[model samples]
Target: MTPVLSRRALNRATLARQMLLERKDISVLDAVSHLVGMQAQTPHTWYLGLASRLSGFEPSQASTLLENGDLVRVVLMRGTIHLVSPSDAAGLRPLVQPILDRDLQNNTMHSKPLKGVDLARLADMGRRLLAEKALTAKQLGAELETHFPDSSPASLAYGVRNLLPLMQVPPRGLWGRSGPIAHSVLSASGSLSLDEMVLRYLAAFGPASVMDAQKWCGLTRLGEVFSRLRPDLVVFQDESGRELFDLPEAPRPSEEVPAPPRFLYDFDNVALSHADRSRVLTKEFYEQVRPRKNFAPQVVLVDGFSAAEWDVEDEVLSVRAYGKLSRADRAAVKSEAEVVLGVYGVRKVVFV
Candidate 1:
């Protein structure tokens, strides 16, 4: 019989692997590789995600890396922008191409406009245009429209986005720097298979289910992948009898282990990566935090579970409890907030 792992057990183990139990003294490049890349559609907010996990993390350090091309923002897992190392961008983007293909094909607005268009030609044109100079999606689309005037420039741009590997150039993602979000062709080369994605997901957010892995990557039919990897993975059952898989040597700490208060960025993978988020949130809190479709609240974790939502304005961090925190929990939240504020060079934390 597969032993049942309780929710708290799952929570502790996940926090340990995610570096929430203790901040890691690792470099930003290594951290990006380990987490498999962060959901980074929003520029500066994502840097806070790294700072929360890595000890002595500095925004300038990450900015410098991005400037040097050691790190880049590209479309990867879930067909969303992620800040990843160039090597990961190379390996992972190729694997998720099918998702982008499906997105472009099924988009109601884009599909009809793009029908009868030679996407191969458009992709070629996109590559050439980007090679000459980095351009925003709008700019790239406008140029392509000159060659295919009848097609929707928006559709043309969407086709280019799906077909070509483009990297968002610097100054766009740099801290305190701004520019038109622009794309240039990515020259990195590598490939990642679905089986490899499963293993990496387990390493980062494990003792997780097929549904969890599927949810994280926005890919379906992964049961077969898990089956093939069963020989190499440790298996257990969650309290509800859902089968969970993890790397054999990965950490599974006791339920009683401490998980201190930490602020999480909106759409942090730890909160969104699991189909069953009971490890990180209660059903009530999950619904409250994710009150609407596509809404993920910036949150504060108390005792390894989300307890409050947070916001920042002009560098003042504000945390609002979902219900109410006990006096001790509130103190813990404020104390961590103070440290986080200082990390960002902010001066105040306001609890509401």
Candidate 2:
């Protein structure tokens, strides 16, 4: 018989799998790879997100990982920047190259300057310059114009970034440090191949549909491998009867799984994992909590749903309730908030 999972059950299972139910005992790099990649549009906050999920979660330790070759910051899935481990980025980048290419062509912001020029050649030149030394986009941009004469500064930066498999080079992802935009090409990282990273995604987040995998990695060219692996996968259906995919060995816990108060970053994958996205935060909750359409570190959950949103500003933590939060649920939220506040050495939390 097919197993049924309640909303909270799924929430707890997801939390456990995501390492949010309890902090994990693993390296930052391992954590990043397991979760696919943390939502890292604004890079520094991404670093913080990873820290929050790991045991001890030392921000400095994660920074050091970024400083060394252990971690990297680059755009992967959906064509957005993410703080990924070196091994993960190397493999994930090539897999997502098509997405990178499409974004380049569709870029209303940059297409004019790169009209007729070859993308491969631009990547070649960028790969060369970034081989020995990392350079800021400012430095890269100046040289790009001199080389690609037809391209404007903005267009040149955008074109080169898309063409070359570049990483936001280190000191860039340090704990409290947000460096000016700088990068090194993919070749310098010397990490795993794209094939391996795609395999890793399937292993960690499988039993997931092609669209689910595509959403996770920001790529969709896995037909051959997925076809080969289909027999090994365990399939299920959402309430709407849409087929859902997953690995047989992966966590499919009972619906009564316990999900504690989780403080998630704005770009967290849990909120974005499924196509429907009803598993985590609802559309109404999103509209209510998020003042702007897109924002991060949405730190509140209760009864398997996003109850409210929280933020750290001027060293103060502020929370806004989206809907009704029961008394017991409010206590749980306060407890988790206090722990997070302790990280920042805040006096207390204020719910507004």
Candidate 3:
């Protein structure tokens, strides 16, 4: 019988591995790679994700890394923009190409009208155009229309985007700055296999179900990959009898382990990576914390589960709890809020 693990145990294990249980002193580049990548669809908000996990993290440090090409923002895993190291962009992007490929075929924006369009020709032309100069989606589409005049510019641009793995260029994701979200081709090699991808996911966010891995990457049919890796992994069962996979030596802390208060940025991976988020959020708070209406909730995690919704407005960090918190948990949350608000240079903290 696979050892059954409780939700609290899973929560602590996740926090320990995610570097949320304690701030890690690793470099920004190292942390980015360690987490596989940080969801970065939002321009500047993702920086807060790193700040909360790393010791002495500064916005300028990550901004400088982006400027110097040490880190890049690109569409990967689940076909969303992620802030990843250049190496991850190379190794992981090619593996998730199927997701992009399917998007080109099935997405309403391109599929119907582009029915017989020579995608190979389209991809080649797009690459050549990007090779000449980085361009935003609008700019690239307008140019693509010059050759394929019959196709709508939007359709042509959408095709190129799905067919080509374009890296969003710098100055766009830099801290306290905004620039055009433009695309340039990635030149790095080293495409990893599906098994490697699964292993990487397990290393970073494991003791997870196969469904969890599939949900995280937006790719399907990975049961074979996990099955092949089973012998080498440490397996367990959750209360629901679903099997979970983890690295053999990965830390599985006791349920009673200390979990400090954490303020999570919108779309933080710890909240989004797992299909069964019961480990990090209760059913009652799920709808409140889930991304909706183009907004990702900023949440307060107390004792490894989301306990409140939080936001900053007019330089005041405000938190609203789901229910009454214990005296100790309340104090821990306020203490962490102070540190977070200080980092953002906010002058006030309020609990409403």
Using TM-score as the yardstick, the better of models 1 and 2 is 1
- Candidate 1 lDDT by residue in tens digits, 95-203: 7888988998998989999999998899999999999999998999899999999998888988998898888998988987867889998998777788988898898
Superposed on all Cα atoms, the candidates' RMSDs to the truth, in angstroms, are 1.5, 2.5, 1.6
What TM-score does each of the candidates earn?
0.96, 0.90, 0.96
RMSD of 3: 1.6
| Candidate 1 ranges beyond 4 A from true positions | 287-293
Q: Write candidate 3's Cα lDDT for 1-352 as tens digits.
A: 7899999999999999899999999999999998999999888888888888989888999999999988988899899989998888889988888999988878886788688789999999999999999998899989988988888888988888778778888789888788998999888766678898899898889889999999999998889998899899998999999999999998899999999999999889999998898889886575564555677788889989988988888888898999998888878888988876566777888889
lDDT of 2 at 267: 77
Report the C-alpha displacement of residue 50, candidate 1, in angstroms. 0.8
Pairs in steric clash, model 3: none
Each model's backbone clash number: 0, 10, 0
Q: How accurate locally is residue 270 in candidate 3, as Cα lDDT from 0 to 100?
A: 94
Name the 10 consecutive residues with the lowest summed lDDT in model 1.
Answer: 282-291
Task: Single out the weakest 10-residue window by summed lDDT for candidate 2.
Answer: 187-196
